[model samples]
Target: MALLINHCPVRWHAIYHSHWTALQYDQQSITYQQLDQLLSALQRQLLTQINLTTPPSMVRLACIASNGIELLLMQLLCVRVGWLFCPLNPRFTATELSQRLAVLNTPYCWIENEQDADSLPTSSPQLQIDFELLLSNLHEQASSSIAVTTNISTSAITLTPLLIEPEQACNIIFTSGSSGFPKAIVHNYRNHFFSALGSQRLIPLASQDHNLLSLPLFHIGGYATVLRTVIAGACIHLTTYPLTVALLQQHRITHLSLVSTQLIRLLADPLFNAKQSAIKHVLLGGSAFSEEHLTALAARGFHYHLSYGSTEMASQIATSDNSSQLQVLPYREIKTHRGEIYITGETRFIGYFRDNAIHKIAAEEWVASGDLGTLKQHKLSIIGRKDRQFISGGENIQPEEIERVCLQYGRVKQAYICPTKDQQYGQRIALFVLFSDSTQFDLDCQQLKHYLGQKLISFKQPDHYLAWPLKLANNQALKVPKQVFLDSLSKQGLT
Candidate 1:
């Protein structure tokens, strides 16, 4: 018999046995039984509060919360009921949330706190379910005399069996919307399950292991990790605070997933040494990583797994194990058409949600990833964005390629490649760099120009250099708006 989404076969094992530790938060450990019970209670409340007699034809639940047991439980409840779960980033402003919410036409929304509820537009009729109140209610019911009664009409609330077909939409994750408003990408159970399973095959996971949950539950990277751990019956350590070197040590975290910027910070910390035996695997992606960064990780004895993935792909397209340098996994395949990477395999997403503007693939399909790469020696190396490429004096240059090289410098914290007008070159390449400390780092424009000249061809070198401080989004620190940097440079008359 095929596995279904509503009734995950794993749940049977989870219900009977309590050995699996589902979550650790605030120094309190929650077992699988506790998690299961919590989910059941939440589901009951949802049914009663929403008057859900039957699951919607197109199930969609909008969840807005940070990383915690509550967020995990909400997702699990949705999966158990075959509901389409949409996890929205808590950091998004009300206007941003409204735009995304409008696309889904979600009937119910779960939010972190009352502040989020207040921020929501009054005109929007969508019900805002307070997470704290819901939790309090669940706790009260669990502790009350009503807990002894098993007479609640479970029959009215039908527990839909999980019959996940290959094509059914499981969830819709929106992009970061840095360039424009975020697009909702629809992924099925197969897409998420395959990503987790494929990753496990490459980097072996055991029931004894524990994974640190620092990534936002809204993003695919963070969301996929939760699914992977639950399927593996492993423990997830949830941290409300930011991921720092001290936190990793405090938790004795074995596995972690980080973006390039996070890894750079970890590497800079004096206490960060790969020789420490506790950490097992550090998966890095989300942006281009410098060759120097890879080499440094290797030198420190830290096991690094480089991945190429996006919201549309569900998480990882191609992953390499650090044990053998950086080689693509055996089961994965990669090919480039017109410099764009096209991935076809079990781990691909079903399609984008609601919007039919984008073309769809036929049955047994593949995704045309907008990002570019080249496959060499059974390994894939990312070049740059095909759309971001600009022309300079009849010569074409990829800014990401140049930025990758610039990031190799130890003092440079982050870099962006933008195009500026030049009378001689037509359109000259410009570099915006963020340094660790301006006082200590004395490298000037001339020195940077010479450095690039030695490493790159004359046409590829950035003609303009601007030193700027890094500023992150108010909600999510990981995302930096490229337009903001460009505007700043233009204001200073540097562009």
Candidate 2:
């Protein structure tokens, strides 16, 4: 399929005519024509005030802004100009942003807040403009100028759209870095295209669908949703900040991508059952969903597609359809190499940004995912992380298996198993849990121990239990970084 982008200005104008609409925070809507004019003016302002070349270069364009129509337009402009777009999460601290920008060697940085621009490091060359100022300036320019003619090509700008190949580095996405500092994973346009196309094959979304933009655009889940929508010629309903069940009902969202924790919270809400009929598919990933939670959702007549994906692979490797059975996509080829999950095919990323020395793909062009799993009957079942397995009493203990078992209990919402230092066993398992309804019902620790003892071998059972509030890290919406939880345990004098 051809890329759903128009190169010629007149062709783009004709193609996008009456095809776009902006859903603002206040529920106000703007047509595609208005959005185009706004983007044209913004593009002109960016060229004039931001010291950007008339047609931009292949240099990186960084932006830190809240979720809005302007941010979306900026991204589109970057794509049109063939510039690498790096969107920083608005939640990042100044220190974190500075450190990342330094490592990325970003020449341009756009900030929505003027104070943030003033606070930027002197060594970095940045032209920060507030969103309000940009919009106001564009509005003022529109009043004075009769025509806003954009020179798509300029001598100063050497970069052309076709010059940047599909394999060329496009975005640098940082991992959650719960273990250490975040690593910038380089992904190309081909990686994203294949990922979106592969996912579309599994879910079968069309132009009639309205995907809810619940996840943060900075993350792959949120970013992929946007790309999928555009590629499918569908509409996206954007929420202001935090995605809640109420917003889902208000927008009457048909499709949504959510983490396991978010799904659990939505299931707990009273309105979920009443409004769930409108939702056709909820793509669940980021972490493993408990069997009990799955059962609960099933009971509510809610449909879900359990997906397994990572940032390094763009988004998803395997995703289930409405049938509730996991289906691997055509572009993705999955196999088990020495009990470790290795994947290859079209959707894999080019490489990481920092470490060019490290080889990302195996001999067969398959990426050694570090995750351990088995393929049975052509279906993949992830066992756990091979590196996360601990030797206990001369036997290997996989935390994921124990956690999966704990999830069978209806009281347990989410569970994680970690190994703590043990003098005799070398390492013993520790269980961290988040209960679904902790106020009225709770999982008995003794009962869980006995239950696991009957199901799993003695070495696999957790030696201790800790109940805490679970929050997914900001970087990637996948796994809860075990290292982060371990640090928290140390801080509380529990480790």
TM-score of each: 0.86, 0.83
> Model 1: what TM-score?
0.86
Cα miss at 370, model 2 (Å)?
Answer: 1.4
RMSD of 2: 5.6
Off by over 4 Å in 1: 1-10, 51-57, 125-167, 274-277, 323-333, 355-361, 440-444, 473-479
Whole-structure CA lDDT of model 2? 0.66
Query: 369-422, model 2: which lDDT tens digit per residue?
Result: 778987776577788877778898899888888888888876777788777878
Please list the residue runs of candidate 2 whose C-alpha ends up more than 4 Å from where it truly belongs after superposition. 1-17, 20-26, 49-57, 114-122, 133-168, 178-180, 274-277, 322-324, 355-364, 376-378, 439-443, 469-478, 491-495
User: Residue 288 of candidate 1: its Cα lDDT?
Assistant: 63
Question: How much is the lDDT of residue 476 in candidate 2?
Answer: 36
Per-candidate RMSD, Å = 4.6, 5.6
Residue 297 in candidate 2, Cα distance off native in Å: 2.0
Model 2 residue 114 distance off true place after TM-score fit, in angstroms = 4.1
